[model samples]
Target chain A: SQKTINPNYSNRGMTLEEDINESNLYYLTNGIAVIHKKPTPVQIVSVDYPKRSAAVIKEAYFKQQSTTDYNGVYRGKYIDFEAKETKNKTSFPLQNFHEHQIEHMKAVVKQGGICFVLLRFTNSDEVFLLEAKHLFPYWDESIKGGRKSIPKKIIETIGYHVPIHLHPRIDYLKVIDHLYFNQ
Target chain B: SQKTINPNYSNRGMTLEEDINESNLYYLTNGIAVIHKKPTPVQIVSVDYPKRSAAVIKEAYFKQQSTTDYNGVYRGKYIDFEAKETKNKTSFPLQNFHEHQIEHMKAVVKQGGICFVLLRFTNSDEVFLLEAKHLFPYWDESIKGGRKSIPKKIIETIGYHVPIHLHPRIDYLKVIDHLYFNQ
Candidate 1:
């Protein structure tokens, strides 16, 4: 019964991924955007094929995603980003992101795609949209033995605040429109 | 083992997927494009987490993809497509495409994204890049008692011939550039 329950974002207990997925569904249904979370990569080592039933994956392991979690077409531009939430009250840990994902975001930015990250502070329920360009310097500094986490105070300065809404729960596209389209 | 062999495109034995993968890698390496094949969707049912080892997926099944197999950005545009190879020499069967993939293509096209399908006739070793707009009419007619397949001759007229090359084996972006960018 609990598994069949419809996702309701009225309660603030929903994870960041759930909130974004619901928002993406709303965007898709309204013809506003077509963003989707990429499927988890799995390495299927062996499978069993029954004569009359569906094939079953008997052995498999999860693989590292080579790119960001979410990407799609929005307003004729390529949209790509990773969504992360932190429980820490003071800073967002850079360890939440992998080095390969950073490189992938750089590639997306080089191709002129709209690349960004959605960082949420779970304690305060605050979400910010930080562009990939603004994040590169932090990543570069971390490799040189700089701080491995970004202070919440600095994040608020450079990132756009994404206010939550009822229809599209996260409403990150509004932030994109304001930052890029001047709408 | 044969699995360890390096992918060499000088010969013609490689599948359409392999060709496109190598092409995407070349494009990514050269900063030409950022296309990637989406991983196969799997519905995980159970997992076994050993204390000292990786979490192993104990039960899973393949899930039908709701979108195309491949998508990414190119020249600041959202590019999306599905690739299928048929052994038939005279016609390409429409059954190879799922209903939801067509719907997904329609959404991408509406968003002004470049959407198309790569049809490869394995018998004749020919590949054609047919835009989603061009394929829609045939799909519509099929539901109203029209032919369930597109003739190879018709494909030649309606689609662009993707010439094979050494570095980027498929060279599908050339067709995109010529048709969309007039380059």
Candidate 2:
């Protein structure tokens, strides 16, 4: 049944990555927000062109990233974020983030960008948009012998739950509108 | 001498990539902007651990990129672009750009993000930022039997010349302030 459905179509129960991408696309098309996934860059060393239409990369290496995975502007405010999914329902580990990423988020917030993390609990099918201001104390506490992670309970208290929808899939901007605009 | 110099020092005479990166770093550190170079993603098929410190990537494949190389938010506006260099002194061939990249830039522009190309004529030691709106027609014209490329002279007429500087390296934000902020 999944095979019979359109591969790129939005209606087949999307993953968190797919859902966020679809929601961003909806936002873009409707002129609501302009967010994009930065391209995954790879260094190519060798390629085999066995056929004109088929070029196979034979050797390559992943380069260290100097930036976040997603960023853009929303309602004249800079928004920067990274998304991660975990199967565990109990706690979200600090180890999920890299040192450079934490440093990057701090820089974004300093520059007045609305920085956040999108955490998805796959088993429970829940997603939350947790702002960086809330994340900062925990990030620092992480170094001070706090739990090596933020428990799901804290996330539930501070972060806004992004609802899943049939049309837009993630529909996170709606939550943004409510949290940032309506308030 | 180059090795003894602190590669990360802001005051050092950095290379072109270094300048762009440091400018981006300056933007990040100052909270004036949030821009970054995306990581190159590679599919690692094999790895060898001959030494504890260095993990040699034995086999890998370069992954195709889905978007432009650099993008971020500045003063609440999304900025997206690709950086390119050419040895040709007179003309920059259109073939250097992929169809997917053009499509990606178009999408960003359509979504109200500032989209453009940061081109460098290495031979002439000049760099220019050419807007997408100015480039699209030329791209179309080239495909339809007009000039197969955009000459440096034409670019000089249309593009905003990015001034070289000590701190912000590329110093494209100055051009942005003049074009968008002044308006």
Among the numbered candidates, top TM-score falls to 1
Model 1 DockQ reads 0.78
**Cα lDDT tens digits for candidate 2, B92-123:** 88877887788777767766678888887776
What TM-score would every model get versus the actual structure? 0.94, 0.77
DockQ (C-alpha based) per candidate is 0.78, 0.33
lDDT, candidate 1, A48-72, per-residue tens:
9999999999999999999999999
Candidate 2 wrong stretches, greater than 4 Å: A1-15, A22-34, A39-66, A73-77, A88-90, B1-19, B29-31, B41-58
Off by over 4 Å in 1: A1-11, B1-11
**Tens digit per residue, CA lDDT, model 2, A36-99:** 7765555666767775555556655555455667787676566788888888888888877777
Error at B35, model 2, angstroms? 1.4
Worst 10 residues of 1 chain B by lDDT: B1-10
Proportion of native contacts present in model 2? 0.43
What's each prediction's clash count?
Answer: 0, 4
